[model samples]
Target: MDQFEVMSELYSDRSNWVDVRRYPSTVTCRRMLRLADFAAADPARWGSCRMAFEVPELSYRELAVARGVSHTTIMRHLAKAEVGDAGDFTARELDGECPEWLRAVSIRFEAGCTSRTYRYAVALCTFAAAQPERWRVLRLAYECPELSQEELAEVAGVSQPTVCRYLQPVRLEVDESFNDLEVIY
Candidate 1:
């Protein structure tokens, strides 16, 4: 289960609330806890939102009254908290159009071999940096070997064709490697 589910289960009982500090230091838990404590919004309200509906003690109306808005506004805030913020994860800087190390590797590899593996590598790296969604699909494929391409696409919120296209470089590299080997038999 994800860290949020674990947090929900932990907070299901009032007795365990005191032990929240001992929750696993996974990304979700760390981000929620940090946001609850340090967000520009009121800490108690953020705590309620972070805990979400999992902790039944804080009512939406109560929060709405505190904020001087309708309960729907409070509900929306809670929903936003549950969804988490996109900026929570650090954005990747372009650093450079192409990293120097990758460029050097591509040059050396191309010089050493007839295969276009290095060329594909450079292309794939550039493609991934330029298109993060494709990179996410590729990453999901690597992280979940048991998952099929369609499943990976589903998990990455992309289409199966897109996943296949993004993975073409890796497939090409593997096929080329096999073709390069001599037939001993």
Candidate 2:
């Protein structure tokens, strides 16, 4: 859940305080103190729209990258925030469904590696999807006709079988590493 959603839920309850954008400057200090007191008493209301308190102008990418979190995570925050007619937030899904080429490798990885998840694989795919340039580097050997298995594995950050899956044209194969995720291809 985005932190804002958490805030909104908290603010749903009643809070008592003057909504003072109209208070007299002669007593601005008093109103400010009262406002502070009100906020302290109802942290949830303050949290729900914390962004509104500051410059309050964060683009989607800026918000995600600044926080070092996924864009999807940011969207969840915004969606839950439900800020003024703000758009929608849908999480991308990348789970299970191993490529046909890795079937064999999936088996091999099982023998000596720890368990991993399709979610993990999809996370990698999500990373790749989010950053296209990175994909070019990872998939470099696919265009090279003379590279050997070790060379492909080195570039792919995975085992030879994992590379072999990439080498195949029709379907991605798995050996045994479905659980380990140690192999990177």
Candidate 3:
């Protein structure tokens, strides 16, 4: 099927609106949560925004009904949330340009941010996206969370230590950022 046809079928049923493939990685999911928290300033919309992503199997109408709002309201919240903007950032990063959104997601920790964990997730994801090898490892790890470091190493055609090495920097960065945030607070 062509892309247009696929999209049409995908959207024809509001009840079946969400497709897991749209979110390809944990990094993307984290970015969506971060964006939702930032853009949906209204607490109600913020909850809707989170539901829209977290419960990917739920349709807009389903989400709206669950939230006791109109489906259009859920749609508006997601539109304002810019959940799809992560793809654009990934595309720009792939094209060798550092996107502004990436910088904002990775660098900024504002009052609107939902949690320290999300900030660290986006920052680590941003760091992974900056390097090709690290990106592959990160993607693989997220896709197969059940896999061990040794298994990931085998999949990536490297040693277990190398897999650990690929992820160590992100771990360290998260730890450092926690300390940084603690000091600032």
Candidate 4:
């Protein structure tokens, strides 16, 4: 189908739009609606922004099925939405802009850290900052504890490794005793 026809069908159902409970309040919903509307005003961005922001629970494949488009098209739209005005930033630029914790990890990784796990941690932070939508998906996964990391990765359009890395810090934080354990023989 043509872009116009696809977008028309997608937006025809108001119930298929964003879930307000996922938002902080009605005000946020209104703000998001305005943004979505603005995004939809441009025919080129309509489908992508809609899929990225409105029905976030659906995977790219699912979105493609719903929209009668290819999965690659869904991915392209979501990617564009994620980039938005921020665009892509280099690791150095991300390090400069990110929080101190992220910066520290990036610095250590850049210094040729021997630990592979540490490098993954750095990659996690860098990826999150670089793709805010993916970060949002990761945060949503925390809320939906029933979903496995694999499921979350599918929803987020990221790799399983990326989902695990995104969640590693939280897992570490909850197991403080692991850090204090000592063995004596």
Clashes of each: 0, 31, 0, 0
Q: Write the per-residue lDDT of candidate 4 for residues 1-185, one digit (tens) a residue.
A: 22222222222212311354432333222333333333434433454544443455678788788877788877665553321223333354456864334422311111221222222222343344344554566566756989988898888788888887777643212212112222222
Candidate 4's C-alpha runs over 4 A off are 1-41, 81-185
Clashing pairs in model 4?
A: none
Could you give me the TM-score of model 4 versus the true structure?
0.24
Which parts of model 1 have CA positions greater than 4 angstroms off? 1-126, 170-185
Error of 3 at 45 (Å): 1.5
- lDDT per residue (tens digit) for residues 1-185 in model 3: 21111122222212211366533344344453343234323556556644554356788888988999997788777663233343443454577784444343212223242244444433443443345465677678877999999999999888898889887644325433333322222
* Best candidate according to TM-score: 3
RMSD to the native, candidate 4? 19.8
* Residue 1 alpha-carbon offset, candidate 4, angstroms: 31
State, as a TM-score between 0 and 1, how close model 2 is to the true structure: 0.22
Clashing pairs in model 1? none
Per-residue C-alpha lDDT of model 2 across residues 12-52, encoded as one tens digit per residue: 21221235543223222222223323334334333322433
What lDDT score goes with residue 130 in model 1? Answer: 47
lDDT of candidate 1 over 89-166, digit per residue (tens): 312113455332432221111222322222232234334434556566656676688999889888878888888898
Residue 77, candidate 2: alpha-carbon lDDT: 48
Give the residue spans of candidate 3 off by over 4 A.
1-40, 81-116, 119-185
Point out the higher-scoring one by TM-score: 2 or 4: 4
The CA lDDT at 53 in model 4 is 36
TM-score of each: 0.26, 0.22, 0.30, 0.24
